[model samples]
Target: MDEDYDYFQELRDFLGGTFHQDISSPEQALDEYINEANKECLLFTIRYCDEFLTSNRTKQEKENYIQTNAEIYFPAIGLTPLIWLNNVVEQIKEAVKLK
Candidate 1:
């Protein structure tokens, strides 16, 4: 990756800059469900995941990073830590593929 290639920014751009919105929900009007706290929490998680991916570290190292921050980052989201981690990883992978 180039020095200017930011995974967090890339992910945000791929998401049309609403990286905090509920893209997973199938609701017709998302604004009805937009919770400020939830959005802030998602932003942190996404930024951490971006750090995970862009670090280019080994699997063990990445998992360690997540585990270390698990308590801080995984509480606000409704899903379990493992599920949220997997979903974010998959989403970022798909985003990378698009580029």
Candidate 2:
């Protein structure tokens, strides 16, 4: 949680400096700060999940856990954030391609 908070703070400072004087509203500010964080988190989560899937030991157990968690809990808690984070990821990817 502390690491997450620090990443967001650093993002806010970086983007705020870049978009200085144009960013408006708390929601906009948060969106700016969290967009990069969301991208990193999405990449990290997918990579970690893939690593867990590939691990020789307990691969089946990890698969069962992810399957059950997705079926039972992720629907209720995951869709919105996943969608929003995905959108942020696309934006970041596009930005990278342009540069």
Task: For each candidate, give its TM-score against the true structure.
Answer: 0.32, 0.30
Residue ranges of candidate 2 with Cα displaced over 4 Å: 1-37, 72-99
Task: Say which candidate scores most in lDDT.
Answer: 1
Model 1 vs. true fold: TM: 0.32
RMSD of every candidate to native, in Å, equals 9.8, 11.5
Looking at candidate 2, the ten consecutive residues that score lowest on lDDT are 65-74
Expressed as tens digits, the lDDT of each residue in 1-99 for candidate 2 is 233443323333443453344555423643564455555554443344334435564645543443333222334434443343344445555544443
**Count of backbone clashes for each model?**
0, 0
Residue pairs in clash, model 1: none
Tens-digit per-residue lDDT, 11-62, candidate 1 = 4343333333445441222222233225444444456556756676776665
The segments of candidate 1 whose C-alpha lies over 4 angstroms from its true place after superposition are 1-34, 37-48, 72-84, 88-99
